[model samples]
Target: MLDLVKLSGQIPGLTQHLHQESKASQERLRRALQVFGRLQQEPQVWQSRHVDWGSHLSFTCASPAEPLENSRPKIEPLKGRHTVVATDGSQIVPNHHEIAYCSLINVGRVVLHYGTQQWPLLDSLPVLLYPSVELQQNSGLDAEEVLALRRAQAEVEELAQLALSVPRRRTTLALVDGSLIPWGLEPLSGQEQRLWLNPLLAALERLRAARIPLVGYISVSRSSETVNYLRLGLCPFLSCECYRYCNSDQAPPCQTFAPLPDRVFWGSLLQPGERSPIWRSGAKVLNPFGEHHIHCCYLNVSEGSVGEAEIARLEFPAWVAADEELLKRALAGVLSQVQKGFGYPVALAEAHHLAVVRGGDRQRFFALIEQELIRAGLRNVAVSPKEAQKRGGIA
Candidate 1:
């Protein structure tokens, strides 16, 4: 359907623009690296200092939980028997074009035991919501978005349940695919937000009660939390009043490293199997987390070459970060998993494989729904004209 002839003419310009941007980005990274070196020299000074920004001025950064000089600490992966559990979820959103207004969530749970004869546990549980309440909420979110929130909650809850089942005698690590922070609840207030958030928090609390270290592994993370904190080191002002001043067209001194991500900076510093200093997340959504406040560190999982290491963000709860031994063991366990899985965590990969809902599966699901409607004596059962046309396609 696309005009290749017309698009071809624009490709050269697009390529040129991308090349120019790449050069500019490399230059910015060079300047940012210099500033990073200066800040690393005396991390204690930066750690002692704190910046007070207004509530309206939101930025992604974290408070240092360890000395800056501890940037890249390598620990040998834990030996002996330990268990790693991971959960991932897939969802089928209610489509208005279809005959039924319902949603489905399938959560895959994986538990792998190392240095033991015990067989790994792998299971997938699917939940169906009929007469979907999410559709009636009118919460300004589409069906897919609503289902996504539900799926996220399900994934964590399942992980928590699995964590509780694991024997406390074995050192166990709980992992989810991405950041543990519950996002997308920001726009909603009061009970609406709590309705979706409470269950997630409760699940996290279960993990805490079980004393199992929970980790959220993020691959190829582009988060700039550490970079944003480093920006303070480059500030020229005696006191930062971002809302009041620094509004002029002239760029602020901190903008020298404006576009750098924490991963790029950390990848340059950390060797394979090494992790950066832990930092507590400054996200507002975490205010409700209380004891579960998220803390993060970057881990270099790959040993390919300089500048080619695969950087991943590892997030955990306050309890895990507070205990030095637990933190090391957790990181070590995760690194061991990463190495065994070939750069990705094997438990998470297996969970994803079990949870993933393919296109053919979707078609089969809808077909089953339609068949049930017919069996229930719904003679007028039909999909929307748009959906019908889509299935038919243009010849």
Candidate 2:
């Protein structure tokens, strides 16, 4: 509707301007296509080795002066045995139809699951933090965005408490699924680091104080900064490298979501130890700024394939009131690019079918979806499209 309005009447000159701009865009894309074509034919072998995830961030804050060498408290897991549990959470943002935010916390085993309906067994974690109605209000933002962020932060804090409180037979590593400091999150700061990172540093300290270990686990593709790195280096206009061509049951790697070279722990707190300092991505020599030396653990994605596609469904929401055509077009470009990178055919774009199945009935819809699956070369198409849609659940 808005496109029609813009093209027809409202902005008057926008439609005329878009034509020229689109032509220019097409020209630029054509040149890039030629380059990509050459690169594709270069016979690069695909390797199954893990991508060096980029966004795994962790920090231990400065511990208070020891109370005359206070005795360490014994922290034990929920069950008798020492176990490592991973917790993940998903967030659905407003502009984006839904945000699948997940955090993996490693602790003593208690049947940990952090996936959506599609991810079975990995369901219902005691520490899963889904967006509650109370935290969903996105208005003119500012206050509301901060409030929602706080609620989300509080949710993680509660998990931290749970994770820390868990019994540590040895050092129980708490694997947080994403960035520790929270990406694109913070107050307009004129305040000190303590205002923001002090409490968090303290919380992590509680675990350290108890001699438990916490490790952050993150999928490479999720970090916006990490994505930006790939974008700037390889495909800036593209949202992802491989999944540009189709909307399939595939997900891009998520750990690539990291900040720029040195921004990982720019103003955060730190806990010093043998490995008390954090190393920035580009640091040729150790910098004394970030406390990486203290929090000896870090993880990241591969430098080359950081932007590659995956074989899982990732949650990227559509706009508030976009029509199917416009929605398809927007996703089409992305799906097209993703498809091209992954070596998949264009027919697999979006959620379309192999052959046009022309009914709105459940049987027809799922049948069409399954037929596409078979054509798309999915080995296991047992889960009907309808089932997948059900599993695809909301966004």
Candidate 1, residue 8: Cα displacement in angstroms equals: 5.0
Per-residue C-alpha lDDT of model 1 across residues 134-205, encoded as one tens digit per residue: 554678776687888888998998898887887899989998998887767767775677778789888888
Q: Whole-model lDDT, candidate 2?
A: 0.31
- Residues 23-131, candidate 2, lDDT per residue (tens digit)? 6654544444444234334313110111221221121111111121112221111322232333443222222111222212211222121222222112222223335
Q: Quote the positional error of residue 206 for candidate 1 in Å.
A: 1.7
- Please report the candidate that would top lDDT against the real structure: 1
Candidate 2 wrongly placed segments (more than 4 Å) = 1-81, 86-144, 185-187, 192-194, 222-278, 281-395
How many clashes would you count in candidate 1? Answer: 0
**Which residue runs does candidate 1 get wrong by more than 4 Å?**
1-14, 41-51, 54-56, 70-72, 136-140, 248-253
Leading candidate by TM-score: 1
Tell me each candidate's TM-score. 0.92, 0.31
